[model samples]
Target chain A: MADQYTIHFGILGCANIARKVSRAIKLAPNCTLSAIGSRSIEKASKFAKENEYPDSIKVYGSYDAVLDDPDVDAVYIPLPTSLHVKWAVLAAEKKKHVLLEKPVALNLKDLDIILEACENNGVQYMDATMWMHHPRTTQMRGFLSDAHRFGQLKAVHSVFSYLGGDDFLKNDIRVQPDLDALGALGDVGWYCIRAILWANDYEMPKAVTAWREPEYNEAGVILSCGASLRFEDGKQASFYCSFLSNLTMDISALGTRGNLRVHDFVIPFQENLGPFYVTANSGWVGMSIGCDPPPTEHLIKTDLPQEALMVMEFSKLVKNIKVNGVAPERKWTSISRKTQVVVDAVIASIGKGFVPIEIN
Target chain B: MADQYTIHFGILGCANIARKVSRAIKLAPNCTLSAIGSRSIEKASKFAKENEYPDSIKVYGSYDAVLDDPDVDAVYIPLPTSLHVKWAVLAAEKKKHVLLEKPVALNLKDLDIILEACENNGVQYMDATMWMHHPRTTQMRGFLSDAHRFGQLKAVHSVFSYLGGDDFLKNDIRVQPDLDALGALGDVGWYCIRAILWANDYEMPKAVTAWREPEYNEAGVILSCGASLRFEDGKQASFYCSFLSNLTMDISALGTRGNLRVHDFVIPFQENLGPFYVTANSGWVGMSIGCDPPPTEHLIKTDLPQEALMVMEFSKLVKNIKVNGVAPERKWTSISRKTQVVVDAVIASIGKGFVPIEIN
Candidate 1:
């Protein structure tokens, strides 16, 4: 008999990001990679062989085969952003826990349908934003919560950009309006928006305004964009995402008494240790030449990589429903929905001539 | 007879920032403090003594006395923004070069009067934005100008913030509407705006929009604010400044092929060596877990402090005009004017209910 605590995961595509999640599922202590489905059986078998999956792991030519397999307790959907609703809801309807990719859907409406299906089927649902599970994230939150250290939130700034080479600009699905229809706003901006919301503890901004006309491809898909968000309590946030700039990921959160900055927020240079800069109660040096007590670095270490931690967390939620007869956890779905809501508002704000868009 | 080589400096006030500039004058090879002026002669004497001015330097009770002194070749005005036009124009009318503090005036109209006086009087006018003279600044410019390394500029973001203590918020001249009335927008945002323009090679943005309602004091003085700027070429810039947040200064500039970030952009953490991060042609690691060949730190050292370099450069221009019979450099005055124009637009945008203000 299989281990009673182990939750089996079925992967639904062979996207590049799926390989990273696959490794995470294999590394997660409570999770087992049971199945992988691709359109071609040869491709699925080759992927399984190349990744060195266990002999018992099954490879299917079509995703439906994996969804029908009762042994596969959970499904990881890493298809294009446009296909998330269809694949995620279908997996939920088939009684499988769903781990959908970021840009959970093209918009909030589809994401809600996927989430509703998961809730109706009593299955766990989480968007694959691995940074949320990083130990450093929790430590940063601790600092932000410390009244003496950070005080009240004042502003948040985030950036995510990477230079898309000639081939990527010409042929990538992200540049194609029909596939990753949200483009960079959905692909990279998803993380930047999530970061702003996370910094504010998921408190929706009262209003969001896009920063004028963003650079778009010939197909009218956004390749670069920015937004400024205003919170109810006079707090503020701004973010930029682009496919035409160098790989630069940053999150800068400023509070009344302290500030925090992370250069590689989306993905750390070193997986084991993540570093961030923070300054508290800093003041000017004599004559205002420089600041006293320069910002110091705080490094957080993790036993399991953040992606593995994400997998373990999702598996625990799934195990609760399977072995303990508890209802599906709503927290994960709630956070994913909030992220999608902001993504939709950003798009809508862009659509309406970059005017301010109310969150609700 | 006087050597006629060194530019004789006459300081218009005893403000705290004046002490730093005074020291820079003393350190600059081509500049020397000749006269010190304050409303109170006793205060001028005490300032000269506390700052350890040379015995030959003169102290006067009235700022008019400094402008009237024939031996003083230039005036370093660190007075409140409200006094900039009055003192700068008067200094120019006296054939004295003006090195005025930033937010050069309350508005562009005031700045134009100052600039016109400098132009009409044939006196070199330069703002005391010292970072523009840092050797590291030149090095960063080199990278930005390199087509292979940086390519076309895409976006710029700047932040300059400090937690002004209780005493500062209560009694500082910056908080007084009749004094430095622009408050943090003029005090800190000036540098942020200048950095944005500098990163974009001095090309003014086509339009500017203030970010919602800014935090203001009871005196109707802005304490914190932000703005979004859009250029004619689809380039974007955004900046934030605050007297309420922690001491954090940053500039993140992105380009098509590369990106650059300066943690301490306004003021270097160290006086001798300034460090900045840059990445060129950086790409994703396998499965997008991380970026490869991460941003590298480049450090540039200067023999003299950036402020001292500013003094020397300004003095050199004054020497060229006085001794070499060259016309006053239009470059310095042009940059100062552009900076003021943007400041005016940002203020106008805020006043007009945060609507987009076109920059002509």
Candidate 2:
């Protein structure tokens, strides 16, 4: 047998999201949850027990212990946005391939420090944007890439919002200025920006203008905001992300020949099926009294949840590097960095009194 | 019975849209087709026969014949937008009620002329924005107005677009500089602007800025354009209209408490059933992995098409004015004027190189 049969993962911080990824790690065929760490060992052990984790996994008091352990080949960091830079760099330097949570370091400069460490040590790095690994996303990409079906994309609109109640508004780490200073723009807005960039085939916008009068908390953290992204090719995109509105995750992309809509984009309404509606080459009939045909619904079914798929993809990359002696994949790291650059630009534009800020 | 049991409609021009309105006039309980007129007698006769107008209805070679006929109580003018002021004003001066097709005139100057003639003659005037009279629209409005379900209006985004193909881009009346001069902004964007105003309880926006570098035809007529509207209350609305993209008509309104989306707002996919999806007070669970409640799809069934409902409403108003000796409804005329003012502001903004134009 090889040095390690399964890619073992050590998770940093027993954050709420860690529980879901813990299950995903167990579900992924070639991934195993080896150890978990929190500031308090009891909390980590309690999380494992509550989530019905097997007794084989180890629990530690400090994140350093998990990164220090020789048996841990990779680390999943779901720590608050503030701690991402310190721990992600340390994990990568320790030769552990890292799957870090997003708003991956608040800004590109801090994220580049971690990326540099990963490059120096030769460790795979991927952000925890689970939906990117979903098979339905692949299908949507196919439609977008087809010239006959979608033609030249003219516009894209994305929205990710959730109604945060009194308790969440007052106490969640997401709203804390120190923990996640970008606030809603960092949390849900990350998805909106990523979706826009994804639809544009990763070509960043020329400029971004944040919409006016954003709601904010007492600490001046953004509660809700929107922005318009201008592309050089004459196509356009806009997005709104809020902690003040009802939950709606939607992406509407319009091309010359077609348009596509996904109402429940971030998370599907059902566990196994993700549905998107697309219409191509639609022409008017009956003298525009009614549309000739309705948008056709395409349903994509997945055996494993998107998070598990994400874990599997990350594990495959780690396996290729650890087993086949291949270099770490830079595509994931590059996309994550580009997404953060746009996010930073949006924040800067808002700070400049909602003026359009040129993206570098 | 009353002196004139039914409001007799005289339709000027044999435009393709007139066929749909012809059916609407026949279907409306209080309305009847009385006269049909065109530039040529042969065309008018062909239209009357093709649409199956009753034998008692008169067919005329010139538009003056319809206005001259004392039996024709009202006139429905479906002519080129550039010609709206002349025909609509003439119809009103002849003491015939007017139902004008949209993009009411080239600008407010022309529209006000028609309005003045109607007021001077004590005749009812209404723009033919068919969706305004849809029962489904009323139901959706109720939801938008509810504080518990949908709270204070925050933002609205509307889109109405259709791929015009080679022929439409080359030769359609919409692309002609002197015909529908505003092009897509006038023909399709009128609906989008009206929708934003409708959602805001008809409150006028404070400022409007056209989106960057609108696509235009060779004659300098807009093929597509988008705009951002700023309201005094910090609310924002945006709209995109195009003759260069696929068929899509959507109105997505966001509020403090909830949000609503109607895919086909201008015209429903199904004539009898108008389905709108709305989500109110949605909360999250499983650490953002899932949303607790999915949006509910509300299907509103109407016995008569939206156009017919529009005709029925117009006939009822005309009946009250002519037979009951009541005053004309100021509400319809006022809303139409407000809509036209916004349309003019959008065009002005585009003309000023996409600068923010203040609304009067």
Candidate 3:
């Protein structure tokens, strides 16, 4: 199956993540970066030239042109967060498989529209939350499957924060109020919220109360936010996200027997820092240092231009669609639905002054 | 003042915590254990004898007898949680200062009765939560006062859990069906809630939601509980307490600039563990590890126990009450009112399955 088909990707943005995804597509055994698109013609031409693609690899000055390309089986949308839904719908309308960036949309309404468009067009639509596809996350789920060992899942606590420099913030969509959908929450917090929901096997929260400060450049962009979500099965997740500071990521799940915490979920094995650490039950027992593989060994390490890992996964899904004649059996629809519900709840909670919002 | 005053103590209920308090009294230079009372006369007598108290120390089977003893200036009531109201009221009626165990009562009505009794009898009534008296907690408050260094106060997370043995299950008042109180939230969660409220300077929560698991033996007793509190200031606190688990104690406050976390609020400094550890902003900066002396230190090592610090600080406000030939001030009423308001909110939240109870 791997050799029989390849996912042909059309890049929709010339951003860093998009470049990484393009490179990853080139590296993926069953994937190829078939085209490049950017708002700037020079940037699109230069990216295609640097990648040394054939003349058949289309270069477009607009996202729709890339979406309309015949050779491109799928589009990786790494545009500003605010544009995720618009491009996702456009790609879906063009019947191109889409890998939309994290958060999917600024609110539930836009997410609903994108979902509808994908359904109507019968094209695969997925929010690119790459951590959900990681082996560590899969392993964590396996460990938690034994209810007796883990006991009743009680609470989940997560944090994702990073400091940004002026250069990173200048062209960064996250800092642009009009381009960025939500600030810390839409960018990083979505990961924390999604991770908690995914780890709990897509349990939808019953209610959520969130608080956001006014430190962001825009009132709508949350500089720092905290949310408490209560689930129907009596489980809870407390999440925090911030862009007003440097990088520090942690996700902890507490149960009757003990707790499982992972530090640096998104990019566990970074150069210099080594593999991510998992502390269980106050570090009473640990696997010891150097036991896990370093980031370079385990992580997809390359200087290739491309989108984030999620984009790469979407490309894989496209390749699957091209070979199988249908989108991969919708195992992730529930996840997408749950994620959207939480995102909607967070937005509602923030608007309502941390008022409890019932997640429908 | 220390040389001139002899701190006389009368204790109700020879429970485990009561025994610890008795020992502390014995160790305190200015304090004397004048009386011990329990439902069982033999138990009270044995407890007095084991402590090697002189014959001058009285042992009473009835709580009222201990309260009526003129030699007993302060009455420590660690009776069954359900009976706390009754005994505290009786002690206050006899003009004896009252130090009651937590929850103060099964409900706010009982707490109000105790408060009224103390006010009418001109006696003090204090809920014995020693964490507030800890020096480290005071230092934490000082650190949080600098809003810029700590950033905008965001949220607080706490958990206090311990496995319950058969003895605790069989006799602990918390498991009693008729008492009608959520077990974990009432037993250990009050401390967590108190810490959250105190850290935020007694800000009343605007809303609260709670979840509780059914009891192992009694249907009414809660085996585990979790609650989310949202304050008017847009700050939030998530707390969990459980009896069906091993010990796990933590309190963490998140602010914009940094965070303040105490590993163990209760018994921070012990013989082996040295002192509680405080980590700020991910342990990157402003980390401090120090022991918190026992509450007794406030009386001997530091200044006189402020009327505000006394459990029965309100007792002095009753008619004709004279302390050192001067009328006692009414300042403690405000603090007690604030504490009651939070306690009421917690009970309401727990009863409503952690529904968002709006505070008036």
lDDT of all the models against the reference? 0.90, 0.89, 0.64
Per-residue CA lDDT of model 1 for A7-124, tens digit only, reads: 9999998887888999999889998999999989999998898888888999999999999999999999988888888888899999999999887888888888998999899999
Q: Is model 3 an incorrect, acceptable, medium or high docking prediction?
A: incorrect
Per-residue lDDT of model 2, residues B238-349, tens digit only: 8889988889899999887788999888888888889887888776666556665777899999999999999999989999998899999989899999999999998888
Going through the candidates in order, their DockQ values are: 0.74, 0.63, 0.07
**Which digits, one per residue and each the tens of the lDDT, describe model 1 over residues B1-360?**
236698999999999999999989888988899999999999999999999887899999999999999999999999989999889999999999999987789998999999999999999999999999999999999999989888989999999999887788868999889988889999999999999999999999999999997998888898999999999778999999999998888999998888888988888878787889898887777776767777789999888889999999999999999999999989988888899899999999999999999987
Candidate 1 clashing pairs?
none
For model 2, residues A1-360, the per-residue Cα lDDT tens digits are: 123658999999888899889889988898899999999989988988898888888899999999999999999999999999899999988999999998798888899999999999999999999889889999999999989989988888888887788888878999998899889999999999999999999998998888777778888888888888888767888888888877778899999989989888887877678889899988666867788578899999999888999999999999999999999999999899989988988989888887778886
**What C-alpha lDDT, on a 0 to 100 scale, does residue B254 get in candidate 3?**
65
| CAPRI accuracy category, model 1 | medium
Q: What lDDT tens digits, residue by residue, belong to model 3 across residues A26-134?
A: 6556677788888878999987887676797788998878988887887778788788777888898888887777767877778888888887887787776766655
Give each candidate's interface RMSD in Å: 1.3, 1.7, 13.6
Off by over 4 Å in 2: A1-3, B1-3
Our tally of clashes for model 2 stands at 0
* lDDT of model 2 at position B262: 91
